[model samples]
Target: MTQTTLTSVQFVKSLYEAFAQGDVPTVVGAMDEDIEWYEAEGNPWHPGHAFVGSQQVVENVFARLAQEFEDFRIDCRRFLADGDTVVVEARYSATRHRATGKPLDVQAAHVWDLRNGKLVRFQQYVDTRRLADVMGVSNY
Candidate 1:
């Protein structure tokens, strides 16, 4: 039997599907050991630096999101791929902010870089002001 590898777009789409199904392990499992994940610069989740490694991304970004939002979802609108890079245009929606009880709906884009079928780098782009407003964060 031959093992079929996913294309960059397929790999990224699979990660989003996994995330939508609440499969954190599968999402994190696809990342390269030294992956560098960056949240949008002005987004509330940004830590002023990239989250290095799967563990750091899971701990700082995923875990915090799980704890902070209710019914959060990513609705992917399009996927564009070229070489090892894949870009996803999407929207983020959450029923409510856990702490502030505010609803969230915002457009987002994600850039994924893969090497040898392993996700090596990720960068996020989103409406920071909208995100900040929903989170009741004034300083974004």
Candidate 2:
């Protein structure tokens, strides 16, 4: 086996793949201990929208997704990197948990900052209107 330094793009790609496969440990392991995670405000899941620390990210972000949705997936359309930051343009789709509703499909962008090969910051940009509609919120 060989070891290679993962580029910023490669790191983000690997993290998304791990997430898709429900590999929680791998996902968490990719982050710095004090990772700052942020999702757009004014969404239904605002409680879990922003947090610091990998533990907080796991509890607030991933846990909320698990509790509120099923089959949550991110389809990366593009990845662009500069220095230690990677920007992802993707589409997110998920089924509402225990509800017979149309699967939610929304466009989103993610900005990730990495240092020493571990993600230290993340901010999410999303189509709020579509996201709100899918989350069953008439207004955000």
Candidate 3:
């Protein structure tokens, strides 16, 4: 009997689904323990933006979202897969804390790499200036 494994694209799709449902634990559980999660540079949320390991990722990336934004959402539009890598084209929407001015909406792309069905690395590419502006960071 041949055992079929999930493709990287499928894995990423499921992860996004979990995220959409606000299932943070499920999303974090899919990552490798030593996952390298990278957010775009110049994002003012974290001083040191690169998160290594599952704990750091959950703490710095996911937790920060919950703390800083009222409603943080990612809308995945497309996914492209090549071998062990999956590229995601998505839009981000969020309401900043303590403000009703405007919801932050922006286009973003994420490059995810998987090893043996476990997410090993992720890199984000987005308009950091726009994100910073939405976050009310001066001189962004």
**Which has the greatest lDDT?**
1
What are the per-residue Cα lDDT tens digits for candidate 2 across 8-110?
A: 7887888888888999899888888988888877656566546889888888889878877788889999999998889999999886643546577889999
Q: Predict model 3's lDDT versus the native.
A: 0.81
Each prediction's TM-score against the native? 0.95, 0.88, 0.89
Query: Where does the lowest 10-residue lDDT sum fall in candidate 3?
Result: 1-10
Query: On residues 37-73, what C-alpha lDDT tens digit does candidate 1 reach at each position?
Result: 9999999889899999999998898888889999999
Stretches of candidate 3 off by over 4 Å are 1-4, 46-49, 97-101
Task: Compare candidates 1 and 2 on TM-score and give the better one.
Answer: 1
Please report how far candidate 1 places residue 16 from its true position, in Å: 0.8
Candidate 1 regions exceeding 4 Å error are 1-4
The TM-score of predicted model 3 comes to: 0.89
Evaluated against the true structure, the overall lDDT of model 2 is 0.81
Off by over 4 Å in 2: 1-4, 47-49, 97-100
- Extract clashing residue pairs from model 1: none
Better of 1 and 3 by lDDT: 1
